[model samples]
Target chain A: MHGECCFESEVLAAVVECRWPERVESELRVHASGCAICADVALLAVALREDREVLKSIAAPPESGRVWWMAQLRARREAEKAASRPITAAQVFGAAATAWFAGACFGASSDWFRSEFVRLASGAESAGIGVFLTSGVGLLLLLAAVSIIILVPAAVWLAVGKD
Target chain B: MFRDATLRDAIAAALAPADSESGSLVESQDVRADFAMDEDSFRSFYDRTARGLWAYLARVTGDRQAADDLLQDAFYRFLRAGTEYESEAHRRNSLYRIATNLARDARRRSVVRPDAVVSGEDIERVAGADSAGSLDLNADVERAMSRLRPNERAMLWLAYAEGEPHVEIADRLGLKVGSLKPLLFRARRKLAGLLRGKDSDHAR
Candidate 1:
């Protein structure tokens, strides 16, 4: 196997440092030139090390401060979103509850609603949609309840966007 | 350990009822309160590792733009991880590991293997002042490297470019040392063959 050898590391070091076959001792240089494994190591190591040096020399990563502040900004946004989640949930819950309660109150106060609901419950061929349309206050309250159901989530969506 | 002390505190405050997974892209806020490295420490670490990490990413992915994006992502994820490290080397390993996985995922997500934009102009342009045949050598390297598997490129680069040993390479690449030797050997041989083939083509 061209994989294991005691001198592979030394040859690799000399090559990486640009010392192989010249700056290093003649004995090692001769060995590296002669041994297949050492020769392969020298070839690849020097090429890669040179490439690495060129890359580092030419490449300029963004300044550390910029990266830091960007991270901080992102973390803050994440935190704000996290904080708003429960609040949003509570808002939706509250809106739904209020809509339900207002509908219940409107139904309890309206004689027309009681008569129509009981008629439907008794499986009677009761008055159709036009009857509820005529029950003015109850109709208004039901419309308001439906509006709240539709608008609250729309408001939350508008406020939060799509995350 | 954070000198600022505000980041995690803010996260903790916000995430009080935090396990709310509803439509959340950031999987869990369970560890939101625990970033161990402070801003100063993070800044210092970024300064130390960014260049090297960028080079590693650029070479492995063959996309400098992807490398740039992934580099920032790696640092952010590292900070967000809130992991406490035992040593500087450990921290580096963790960062590199995160970077490696991100690059891997990015590659898998990419519909096609990204073209090797690591051109001769980048490498030989620097060594242009130095030895003879530097142009041909660098071009050959870039060409040969593009042909290897990403893991192979990573192993060889870590070994030669970063001068990391087999054990550390294995750890960073998520391979056991026992399995790494053969794989590294095979990769190195493939690389040598490609380089040799290039030489022969020129000779012909």
Candidate 2:
């Protein structure tokens, strides 16, 4: 739309630069009619414009509504899927933390029991039987501790995952 | 339904090509403000733009199936981006940018596969004529398009097929406006030569 040599610039931009036009402007047509250089530009632009229409005509895509519906459904599903991942991660972390807390508590309680048993056994006149009992009890506590540490969190995590 | 129609009108106006010299930045801002956070709004927007976008994807990738998958991915990423744009053109450009990047990444992940065999019924449908000649020509055009590098194909399609201005095409393709001209020139010349060679082969 610029006057003088800017017409050539515009024509060049339209013809060689972008090689497309949504619509040919009358001003450009007028200028091209007057200028030989722009005349060739105009011809090329017109041919390209025709080619654009031909390409468009050849392209018959699937229905817009159908594509849109599929996109909507996909977006919803993806959002839902993305929302679930963080929750799953948090659940796993929560399960592990809970297991560690439970183990610590079980270990502390076992220590208390062992200390009490030792205290009582040390103060006993017949400490051999008491020491044997303490050893037996300590073994049972260790087994209980191992079982709780291994089984409880596995059960909790799986149950949470199912939900 | 009335409210939905009103929303659709608003979005359409927002996305309509800029009319004023200053561009539709202000109008688009107003439209973005009204962008409904519901599926219905997004669906309406999709209805307005999907076919052209899908056709562009199909043209660029030369695989209808990849187009289908990429179309969904493009829209999904657009919705997730949640960007406020200066104009409808800007939003559309952003969508194309996303689509271009996705297409490029997908192409990098896997080599271009051979074209699927076109069933007679499908070819007939595409040709809309009984002439097998037109079907062959259409297939040839697609094959020729596939031979171009992905970015070259995109630039050519955006320039000649989509009628996008250099500035918009540059924006979508992440190229400088000044650089688009020479690139487009080369692409157009190559395409013209391919078409000419195809015509000559048919003459023989």
Candidate 3:
């Protein structure tokens, strides 16, 4: 029984590691001839290992692969048309300009800056330096707006028409 | 676990076929089934697995944003795939494999792009406050996982965390089971070494 128990201990290690083979089973049978305890331990260990695996199997959650794959497929589908459409220099330029315009608009509309602009405009009539600076800024703004209204559309048309 | 029968029934009901005059569209039904996953299942699954997937992807790409995108992408794919498994274990193994592939593909497509949006500090902060297990252990695991090659990490995590059998893992990974034993041993040794390093660093 002692010898059989020792043999079962050895088999238990192999079984835990999932390395059990036919030879190990045959060897176990030979050892079990003398040791019933060893035989019982061997059987118990196998059952325990099987139970452990079953519990592990049960505890595991579902795979998210199909979900991940679906996302990949969806991304591919969404990207397909856009990917086929070449990114043009005009698109880059337009994006940059749009960003700049938006930033400028945000800056202009900000309360802090709007208050400062009002203060400067109000003080311009009283201060000679303010008057010249304000009018100079006003004229520049008008010129810029007019230039953008004309040249901007023309450039956009040129860029678009090129393609 | 049985006490959660109500939630399971909810999921089952959500997965149940809808009656229609037109021939039932399995494809559409499958897509809608995710909604039936109940808040509990979705939250539990996301909480338990999403972070692991994210951490794994971040380690692979060394980018937090990329990991986040991939994580979301992975979940979205899972929702759309209509994959059915006989058991949750099979489902999880499949999910990890898919996530690994997605991360690999993303890495291949853009080497220069940032893969993860969140910084390591942010991840640590979130993990630290988490009540699940010790943050240190999770951190160590993440650092250890970071050191492995993509496939090695995937194999180890699936084996250790998911406790999948070699055959199931091999099937999921499209590898022969015979080829996995030695590879798994080596990967585990490497991960153990990495984890030890993390522990040592933390100790200091």
Against the true structure, what is model 3's DockQ?
A: 0.02
Candidate 3: where is the Cα deviation over 4 Å? A1-163, B1-49, B111-144, B197-204
- TM-score of model number 3: 0.41
Q: How much is the lDDT of residue A137 in candidate 1?
A: 55
- Please tell me which model should have the higher DockQ, number 1 or number 2: 1
lDDT of 2 by residue, A31-97 (tens): 6667744553444344443333333444455444444444444444354455567767777777777
After TM-score superposition, the amount by which residue A82's alpha carbon in candidate 1 deviates from its true location, in angstroms, is: 2.9
TM-score of 2: 0.58
- The DockQ ranking, best first, is 1, 2, 3
lDDT per residue as tens, model 3, B73-188? 66766655566666667666666777777888887888426432333444333422332234444444545555677778666655554445678778767789878867765765
Q: What tens digits encode model 1's per-residue C-alpha lDDT throughout B31-52?
A: 3354557767888888888888
**lDDT for position B203 in model 2:** 15
Interface CA RMSD, all predictions: 6.5, 10.2, 13.5
- lDDT per residue for candidate 3 within A38-141, as digits (tens), equals 44333333432332232222222334433433333454334433443454464658855965795586577577546646756676756744464556655555
Q: Model-by-model lDDT, in order?
A: 0.74, 0.61, 0.53
Best-to-worst lDDT order: 1, 2, 3
Tell me candidate 2's TM-score on chain B.
0.72
Residues B32-76, candidate 2, lDDT per residue (tens digit)? 333323456566667667766766777677776777778778876
DockQ of 2: 0.11
Deviation of model 1 at A131, angstroms: 12
